[model samples]
Target chain A: MKRVGLKDVAAEAGVSVTTVSHILNNVQGKRINAETRRLVLEVAEHLGYQPNDLARGLRLRRSNTVGFVSDEIATTPHAGQIIRGAQEAAAQNGLMLLMLNTGNDRDLEDKEIALLLRHQVDGVLYASMYHRVVEVPQRLASVPTVLLDARSDDPAVPSVVPDEEQGGRTATRELLAHGHRRIGFVNNIDDIPASRGRLAGYRGELAEAGIDFDPSLVVTEDSVAAGGYRGSRTLLGLDDPPTALFCFNDRMAMGAYRAASEAGLAIPADLSVIGFDNQELISENLFPALTTVALPHYEMGARAIFHLQQVIDRAEPLGAAVHEVLHCPLISRDSVARPRT
Target chain B: MKRVGLKDVAAEAGVSVTTVSHILNNVQGKRINAETRRLVLEVAEHLGYQPNDLARGLRLRRSNTVGFVSDEIATTPHAGQIIRGAQEAAAQNGLMLLMLNTGNDRDLEDKEIALLLRHQVDGVLYASMYHRVVEVPQRLASVPTVLLDARSDDPAVPSVVPDEEQGGRTATRELLAHGHRRIGFVNNIDDIPASRGRLAGYRGELAEAGIDFDPSLVVTEDSVAAGGYRGSRTLLGLDDPPTALFCFNDRMAMGAYRAASEAGLAIPADLSVIGFDNQELISENLFPALTTVALPHYEMGARAIFHLQQVIDRAEPLGAAVHEVLHCPLISRDSVARPRT
Candidate 1:
């Protein structure tokens, strides 16, 4: 069936196409009487007229279009929630999203951002797979932009990222509350922000618990299953192995579980363990389901879209760039318990 | 910095906008001289003119745009790879995608499709998360449409879907080759096509191995971690438990691991297990790593977009609807092993 247009609505309502456009598009509606406005709207609704968004978008200075640029996010299972949340939030505000998946190629990203600008997207969301500092692309300055799950060195650009330090504290505290001391930390390298912040939280919790920091109990590893396994082995092989361990993320924690299993130590009963990044795929399925801190990818994505809208509406508002550090709440499951004293 | 337009290139090339449009937009090379074409192209490259895709799209009978409509496929992690493949394939063809995520609301989907129709999308890809028959939206008839990972009652519409029966057979064969005579099957309900096909494959593999069909060996359960756990418990509680188990999916396989652990059986040592859907998040991280059949979500997606382009280009070819059943290849890991003699 042919799509209903302004002409069809006008013919049905016995009015001029300009009158229908003026009333339906809300352009110069003062001249249109209420009865005429009602008649035009009723006819348009009955005919199912879909006003050309691009034409109206130009007149209203609102494209009703948002551009989403991501690096390998579309393929990551754990992070797909971010897109889902952003889509829902965009729809609630009458916006349609056109997504560009760049797969982390800087040149492709540059081209994609340039294309989005050419489209005159109302706003742009640059999302990354993890919390890291990214160099701001010069071309992104042309539109209202926000970073999701990533931050920028340029303090002027706004970012919505997870509070990793808080997550570390939450995970460590859960172990502490389980009557554990001499806790081990299977950490990522210190070069990244997450490691530095999480390590600080780990140290702070240890100090608060009156447990002196033990350099022997910590092992640095890459953020993968093999890294977690190796890290766990190093910690378990220590002369004085800690009663519990806090892994940097869930994937690492899976490796830790392997180490514990290899050593003939049962979870919770023999050695308690806590993890971060509650990726449901691993955390929910792991034997004795893992207790870990959540990343809030969905919330961060929703908040960024909401913030981008605010950024777009502002007219030279004076304030510091918004840096939202949303909470990474602890999800308690079967992974934590009291140490065997 | 201002975005360069056709007008900027026209003035720089010392030619009319129509001439610049003809060369830059590839309107008609025969009408314009080669020198003028070369000068206009050189000036366009130097001025960094970004051609208006919408306007040029009209002359070429191509919108340079494809519409992707999904019913919660964007939300489900298992299906996100589908979008990833489609995006990459679309980009390779110089077609940008405008996605509509309806979250499975039929009314919202109807409206979203109406919007896409109004935009004059070159073609449409209607994707579903599961392998099931869906009613083709009446409005989709106007555009060249292809179903991704979904089928329709009307045979005229083409679809690209996974071969679930083959997947089931592949998983069971992997277990049988490991020297298992009694293999247990944990399946989903029979109403779904996947379940029915997989069960047939399971029986097919067992029959090929010269084993009698044991009705007591199979248990139908929900496709989740809890379901796998429950199904495993029922199988193991038998007077003589099977040495091997084949789970419907990775999530169910996880529960199988839990059941083995509780029963004091080591994976691939005493109770060998095989799974379907190599969801890396679960399969890779599972204690022994799961061996399962892989769903060709990415290939299905990529193929659908490529097929839609074919359907769009074909000039009224008469034939039966194309129904492509893709292979679900097996990913060997550490899950399967020889049973105790």
Candidate 2:
């Protein structure tokens, strides 16, 4: 069967092809009453006249598609939520998502961004697996781009990232408010932005309480479960061990639980522990439910797409660099408790 | 910087535009020598001549793109890994991904698939938030399609899903080998394919072991932490509680753990438990560590793209139903143990 086109819709509606195109694309300044618009839509629907993206893209010089470039999809657990948000927002605005997986290779990212640009995508969403400052590839400069879960030192690029500093502070304050003073801080090496931001918050909270930060109480190691186990052991081995501990993320907090259990330390009796990023698995599986900060993963996804749509519609100027910082709520579950003197 | 095209590369390499096009696209039977191919590539590289996807897509009458349709990203934690796998495969084969989030709305799914078809995507990858079968919209019949992590009773469409039946059997057999005759099963409603398939495996193992399948030993509930907890309570409240239990999924197992802990049941000694879907958080957070099945999430993603690519290349005949069953591996941690007398 021959496919219906703009001409067909126009002919059926007794309107010019130009008017049909303007109405379909929602171009302003084409004076048409609601009655005429309704009639044209009805005619188009009856004829099954789906708008041809190829023809529309050619005419508008915009593909009505956005490219989402991410590092390995499997490694980053939170990224799926972000992608969903972006996809939903894009679809609502009649935009399609063209996704590229960089597999954590910088060279691949360069090539992928170049390919997206070659496709003339209306915008690009660059998501990194790790929360670190990534150097924006030069090829992406021409595209209206947004960074998700990763930040760039380059002020020219817009970024959407979790407020890790606030999350860390909230987790620490929750433990402190429960009347714990000698608290241990277990964290990954402060090389990544998230780690550094969290550590800074931990220290800030301690200073606010006029409690001097103890160097011996701080255990810096790997961020994985094994790393948390080792770090917890070291902290517990200290001559004057802390009554409570604050972990940077939930994975490490889980490791600390194992170390505590091996040592026969009853939770909230011998020690209290607070973690960040209330990973669903951790909150449910831990002996006592984990009291951690819940990162606004879904919101981040939704907001990024909303911003991208704004750039796509030209409602917001492209390359204006709109940086949005979202807050993580403190989910007070069962892990934390008062310090027994 | 005037954008370089085929003409510029041909002029620089002193060859016909058709020769350059053939060399670039790797078209066979062109009779181009190695020297000419090398020179043409070198000149194209020097000139930074990136093939415009828009023009190429128009010329080929194919988008060289695939649509990945799924529900909201936040609800489905497994999606990230799948997307990563698909992206890697797509990039390797020079295909781009068009992502559409349906938010689990049936009407929206129908509309988005229509939109993807209108965009002329080479194929579609329909992924579900969970392991359940939904009707594949009749409108999508014209497009080459693959279902990921979901199955349909219909034999017409190809599907790539994890081997949940084997996963359930593996978990149950592990407990049986540890000398547990009285084993209880905690599962979600049998409506879901994964739930039903897993329960079948559990029953099959018991039958093979010459053990009578006790209907009273199986507790079917919602697939959530709270549900697992409730289900575990019911099993333990019995006059003769089983020594070992197999949970349908990690979350359900976690709930069981809480119930066991509340009943002052020491793990392994008083009650042994095993779960499926080694969700990283679950295994790590569970006090004794969770010995569960690791779903082939990454492989499923890769396979979805592989199948779609096959359909697009016409290497595999179109409209031929292809069913690829992927396996899940048993990851033994600390959760399961020999039942004590």
Reference interface contacts recovered per candidate? 0.45, 0.59
Residue by residue across B1-341, what tens digits does model 2's lDDT show?
23577899999999999999999987888798899999999999998887777777877777788888876656656777888777788878888889888877889888888899788788888887676786787766667788888777787778898877888888888999999999999999757778888998899999999999999899999887788888999999999999988988888888888798779888877898888887776665676787888788888889988987777677344555788878888898887788776
B168: Cα error in model 2, Å: 2.2
Count steric clashes of candidate 2: 0
> Where is model 2 more than 4 Å wrong at Cα?
A1-44, A233-241, A259-271, A284-287, A303-323, A337-341, B1-47, B233-241, B258-271, B284-287, B309-320
Estimate every model's Cα lDDT from 0 to 1: 0.83, 0.82
Instruction: List the lowest-lDDT window of 10 residues for candidate 1 chain B.
Output: B52-61
Worst 10 residues of 2 chain B by lDDT: B311-320
Q: Which digits, one per residue and each the tens of the lDDT, describe model 1 over residues B184-249?
A: 998975478788889999999898888999999999899888889999999999998899999988
TM-score of 1: 0.89
TM-score of chain B of each: 0.95, 0.86
Q: Model 1, range A77-112, lDDT digits (tens) per residue?
A: 755678777877887777767778888888988887
Candidate 1 wrong stretches, greater than 4 Å: A1-49, A58-62, A314-320, B7-23, B29-47, B57-62, B136-142, B314-319
Q: What TM-score results for chain B when candidate 2 is compared with the true chain B?
A: 0.86
